[model samples]
Target: MATEKWVFMVTAQTPTNIAVIKYWGKRDEVRILPVNDSISVTLDPDHLCTVTTVAVSPAFDRDRMWLNGKEISLSGSRYQNCLREIRGRAGDVEDMEKGIKIRKKDWEKLNLHIASHNNFPTAAGLASSAAGFACLVFSLAKLMNVDEDPSHLSAIARQGSGSACRSLFGGFVKWTMGSKEDGSDSVAVQLADEKHWDDLVIIIAVVSSRQKETSSTSGMRESVETSLLLQHRAKEVVPKRILQMEEAIKNRDFASFTQLTCTDSNQFHAVCLDTSPPIFYMNDTSHRIISLVEKWNRSEGTPQVKF
Candidate 1:
């Protein structure tokens, strides 16, 4: 066994993303595969993100984690799945200076200690999990010396959070919902880098920082089970909308992009309402804010701000 005194770790920061074409349901729940293709714009890491530190040591007996300085269980399938996938791809790591050497096969026997902190509120409908899980997978991959590309690592992150797949990229990203049962082909791809749409400004409205009563995972499951609209969306609406969104993004058509973004966001909430026992992710304040934006856009004949 290697010396228990030495600790080898890697730290990484990943940004949260906001979906333009929102992902509302899942076809494979255990894999966290989405029901439809969704596109998103990655946010600035300096503003909102998750910073994760993954440490490996011989002294540790088991995998453990802490979120926001609070110890959290790693027994959850999301965490376990990411760990398993990354470990499977683990490569031999050696550091002569630190006098540490880990063979590829040694990863399975080793334990990890992870500490993650998110700048934004978690589970408050701000897509914090997107950043949190992405950072978790990314930092661990670095520590394990996994040689996979970002797209490959994104597939692993998707198992942690569906939107997390998109966070692996810089600016515009699309998560393709693959038809395969194994979800091997389902992964996120970068559409455009941050410099592609440098003129665009993103502003997030803070309605409530409180935790949501219904988590996105549970709500998505409910919608998939009971909402016919969600099925229709997965089959019909999003496919065409995705193409349009792609064009709008490519052409830098601000008007078209804003239209698609606002439309998809509203329809996503509508799917929630269509579900049995209807989920209400937005509040009265949220509705009023949307209405105000619409009114202003109408008066100006162009979008000043898109919700």
Candidate 2:
């Protein structure tokens, strides 16, 4: 394997997801197990997604990655965890044309060169990490000939970013907060395929392109430490909301869908405000947009938008 000059590569693209029933807190930080069940809608991959190419070569000295054409560190525990997990599941590979044969055990010794690019702006309050991690895991899994399903691969992606698990599936997906301590059962399941709700239209308005002052990881950590509303939301409010949202999705009840979506988003913001020092994710412009949408809904006698 060391003498081979050929590089085995695979490229994959994954879409980002918007959580309708948000996952804000974690029960296990290291494993990235969320405190409550959350549901998300996977966006169109053609519109917002990450394209990652993973190449494994015997000549490469160490694992490396480039994000958006800039070299980035792979020393982070998240990246290392995903890499290790995927490597552990790798299967034997043979490329007859390239005259390359890689045994399952050989994956551990081989180094990887990964290059990822996002079509959308990263760190601008969008779910870029979700798409990025999902793309990384998906591409490496393909390159290594991992036999695991998307659900199994999603568990690895979850360690990178909790919301990343939901990005592995299309359409309406749910991440069930599994009760297992090992977090093996915590995986994303598809409720419906992308074509199920073709009538639905989603519009995203970006208010700012700057990186957030408080990342979701740090913000959620603060909420877990300080916000009582976060605790209650996880324990009491989200449970009922999850069931209702699931039902609304199953039945395609647009009215109930709009109601639940708006309420859950408001509650998420409320929890943020309830945090110590009150993390502000939405600015004045965001507030104005919400107000305008609410007024429009009132005038129309039905909900028009879910912000």
| Total backbone collisions for each predicted model | 0, 0
Which candidate leads in lDDT? 1
- Poorest 10 consecutive residues of model 2 by lDDT? 1-10
- Which lDDT value does model 1 have at 217? 85
lDDT of 2 at 233: 91
lDDT tens digits, residue span 95-190, model 2? 888889999999989999999999988988789999999999999899989998888988999999999999999999999999999999999999
Model 2 accuracy (lDDT, Cα): 0.92
Total residue pair clashes for candidate 2:
0
The lDDT for every candidate, in the order shown, is 0.92, 0.92
Return the number of clashes found in candidate 1.
0
Off by over 4 Å in 1: none
Model 1 agreement with the true structure over 1-307: per-residue lDDT tens digits: 3755779999999999999999888888999888899999999999989999999998888998999999999998999899999999999999988889999999999899999999888888889999999999999999999999999999999999999999999999999999899999999999999999999989888799999999988898999999998988889899999999999999999889999998898888889999999999899999899889989999998778898
Model 2, residue pairs in steric clash: none
TM-score of 1: 0.98
